[model samples]
Target: MSTGKGPVGIITGALSGIGAATALEFARLGASLILADIETQSGDEMITKAAELGGTATVAECDVTDYAAVERLVARTTADLGRLDFLVANAGIAEQSRIASGDPARWARVVQTNLLGTMHCVRAALPVMRRQGEGHVLIVGSTSGREPYVGEPSYLASKYGVVGFAYALRMECAEYGVRATVVEPGTVDTPLTRRPPAVRALLEQMHPLAPEDVARALVFTYQQPPHVVISELVIRPLDEAVNADMPDAEPR
Candidate 1:
């Protein structure tokens, strides 16, 4: 697959961070990619960069929170690229406020984008993959899902919801020859992680996992043989303090 035009896949939130890093890694393997995001300028820029790396890529302005937009993104990929081999549901947001005093609106955004957004991408793409008799769905989750932490009520809830959804999805897609895998990563240096000052300090103090680190793991999971189903993967920095100090921190 790396020798020529590779797997046809769509990556939500492909403009930056882990999403962008993943896109470039896939490009190095010569994959055909649909860089999906709400941003157009960065999408265009990523397309150029992917082509420079010898991958065929295009941009789709998609809001994963909107099911209709997600459906259209899947449709466009199949219509324009011939088939959908994989779906990377990586679009997400982070929140750092306590539920008792936090903005409900922000909480809603976190849940909608992190959890519902993943569901939208999977729902829109799974049917196409089922018809194809082969496909992969890789969701970018977080360490927050695996354990409870302070100051990240909604974000953790959403990720935990995603972990549940991925396992159930794996069962449903098993008979259809489609695979579902959720990658949970610890702190990563990304735009999303840098949003809040407290999280930013935590990020700066430690040697957190880079976006490319998570991206490589994602590609390896997808590149596995058809029969191999890597149900779940969790990656964290070697430093135990990352978890001990800021347990609520996550990767986007």
Candidate 2:
């Protein structure tokens, strides 16, 4: 798993939640990090934490919805770090609304951030990985992508799109030594998931998966031999049903 030189990678949505946890885990592994997020204050805090962990890290104020911004992020990371080793397309958001009653704008935003945003990161990073002839791309997906849920049509669509994209990207990148993987985690306890009281309560009862749990999974995927590619991984907390009844719950 050791790269003679420290591994360098970019993680989108690194300000908090799974993204932040992944950055910290990479730091502990002695990886050079490019943490990208739109939130300036939180991004700075993460940068400080990465430094405290003795890991080299820089913050990129990036909005994944902006392809140009994502391009610059990849360019800056490679220009400064000397190599691009991994890309984690983890920038995502969720809204609670039904297709029949949901806000059109909100649904669109979800699609843009979760689906289009991931595509932008992949498009930006694939070239660098191809050039290097070795790289890993981890797309943070959700259980909703694999199974249908009750609410949040947009979020579901977006995640489903991510899963589909990962599969296609993996095939396309196979010849170039770039591994594409989709890590689907279920009911992770994070600020994003805690917003809904009912959903949060249900997750708490299920002993929901922590952000670190998913982060560790990412690290494992990255640490594997270059010749081995884990195409898709679905992780969930024990005793937690994949798509439990959530009559009142919304998408996340």
Taken over the whole model, the C-alpha lDDT of each candidate is: 0.88, 0.87
The residue-level lDDT of candidate 1 at 48 comes to 86
lDDT of the structure predicted as candidate 2: 0.87
Query: What are the RMSD figures for all models against the true structure?
Result: 3.4, 2.8
Error of 2 at 186 (Å): 0.6
Tell me the tens digit of each residue's lDDT in model 2 across 1-252.
222356899999998999999999998877888889888687767877887876777888999999999999898887877789899999999977667678999988999999999999999999999999999999999998988877778888999999999999998999988998899998899998888777777776778899999999998998899889889999998887866855455444
Per-candidate TM-score against the hidden true structure: 0.94, 0.94
Q: Candidate 2: where are CA atoms >4 Å away?
A: 1-4, 247-252
**Residue 243 CA error for candidate 2 (Å)?**
2.5
Write the residue-wise lDDT of candidate 1 on 1-252 in tens digits. 222458899999999999999999999888899999888787778878998988978888888889998998899888878899989999998878765678899999999999999999999999999999999999999888987767888888999999999989999999989999999999889998888777787777788999999999999999899999899999998873544635333333
